[model samples]
Target: MSIKTTTLCALLGLLAPAAAIAQDSTASTLSRLLECKLTAAEVAAFTDRINAEDVQDFAHAGSDASGDAALSLWKSDAPVTAWGETSDLVHLSSTTEMLLAFKVTPGQELARGKAIVDRIGGMAPRPDQAAMEATYGWKGMDFRKPLSDNRNVRVLVDLSYSPGWVTVGCAYGDIQ
Candidate 1:
């Protein structure tokens, strides 16, 4: 083969994987979840995609309040591109809500979180970062979208930054 052709082929080969990794970013995953209705079947498919295992012992403050009021959780640490590294992913389902939480690198949280927020229609205005940080260790915003049955799905995004880690939680369910 000609030298020019061979070098071009090699460069293209290197770029292919980089392009794939960028498409498979955490932001994309979160965007997909934001679009989801969080139905039981949809949740099952998501867990299968991530290979998340059931958390048999998972419990929350109200888990014991009643027999059917228990919370269900699934978690996976499977390596996927996020902030140039892998981060923990958790899914929680309860009678009234579904939540997806994943960790992103501290410094990139706001920019990345906002990107996810921008994808959905009717999103709230970007919260003030300075006031948010001053008020607490996390920043949160909320918006609601109507579903086919006329019920509204309320979505909440919370970005929590601690000394060593940053976690972004997205929760959605019937507004009522």
Candidate 2:
């Protein structure tokens, strides 16, 4: 399709249900980018003017309990050992419930987040999730990659990282 056509389609996408559009843009953008890495400052710059509330919410997904717990983790003063900064990832999803793995601790927030998802969808982490660990060791996956996860759910740990690979996903959905 021509660039104009593609742009028009994306613009039209905005008219769809909020959830659908967010998921669509998120998936398409990530699929096209494949892998992305950036520093805290870089991410902030790329994300435009990130608000203070945005930092507070961090990885949010609707009104799920797990997302609440995950937000607590993000709010914690855990000095990012080797993260891109703030275990906070800025996503392109329209859904309020989106989280990027926090590398401050492996599976720290993911576990809690999954618990919330389970309560909602009753789904478990897929085996394919291990791809990140294999490609970027757990250490690299968390501390170095944009997302720090144990490869247990639909979360994409490949959104951003410092030195490793990760794939990040949206809450209640998939962005990879």
Candidate 3:
């Protein structure tokens, strides 16, 4: 090959692997976040301030409403010296769903969390499945286009049953 072609080929070869690595890393990060398994140290660091009562309620209730209540109490007028349970990661089928709450600080925490969810949701497949489908091993769902006004901060995740590995839906709304 000519010198120019040789150099171009070498550059393309270098770039191809880098692109593949980036895609793989993104996929891996999504997988890990979906799994939602926190190390002992990570748990301690992230949830030390979360109240025992809050965690108990979330574990027992296992509903978005319960999460909202806990979030409200945490964000009450009293100083929040602690972080509420940030996420309750639930696994159904071969996929993981995460319920996250942040003790908003100067609004950054909530905004950051929203951004992350949006990014992940964008990668999910269309016609999203429902939580019931994944949990009960029912058929998958095909969602209509995302509602234009459906902006919420709470994450509602559904993993696909057919592919059985892709995240199908992630919805968010503000804690009401």
Candidate 4:
């Protein structure tokens, strides 16, 4: 299958299992994903926890590292409430760092990005239109909040918007 098709399936596959939970919602899953909160083990068990037979186009892009979780990514077609469907989704993990990156559908970048910043824990004063444009040169801004529970695991929410592309996601790990 094409990369786009595969990516879309992978993301749906990721969310489908969450939807089955008693009270889980797409926003909940999105929050966890944006925070880079899902552990390697949880991600690995996705295929088994959620029946592949039921989710269309779902594929567990399998990992190879035995003890350490190698870099892995999951894409989706699931749309967030108040936010449009993501164009792309990615997750990366290493011994010292983990990052989640996703491209938000146009027109919803600002609201979605702000909501994500709030969900992950806000930055001082919050970010606004002028701030994003001034700091990031039009349609760009980033806010970081070190996990209060774990100072070592810092996380940040970033939004980048350009003529034809917009990415809103987060990164966590040994970030400076």
Order of models, best TM-score first: 1, 4, 3, 2
Model 1 lDDT tens row, 1-176:
99999999999999987766544543355344434444545545554544453322222323232223222333332322222223333334443343444444656655654565555455554346457657775554544545553333343444442222222233444433
Give one digit per residue, the lDDT tens place, for model 3 in 1-176.
89999999999999988766654543333233333333334333323323343332123234442232322211221111111222333222211123333323332432443445555453333333555566777443333224333321123222222122112222322212
Candidate 3, pairs of clashing residues: 127-143, 152-172, 152-173, 152-174, 153-173, 153-174, 154-173
- lDDT, candidate 3, residue 33? 32
Per-candidate TM vs. native?
0.37, 0.25, 0.27, 0.35
* Two-way lDDT contest, 1 vs 3, winner: 1
Candidate 1 Cα deviation (angstroms), residue 163: 8.0
User: Mind giving the per-residue lDDT tens digits that candidate 2 earns over 93-140?
Assistant: 433222343442444544544433444353444444467567755422
Q: Pick the candidate with the highest TM-score.
A: 1
Task: Supply the global lDDT for candidate 4.
Answer: 0.42
Total backbone clashes of candidate 1, pairs 3 or more residues apart or in separate chains? 0
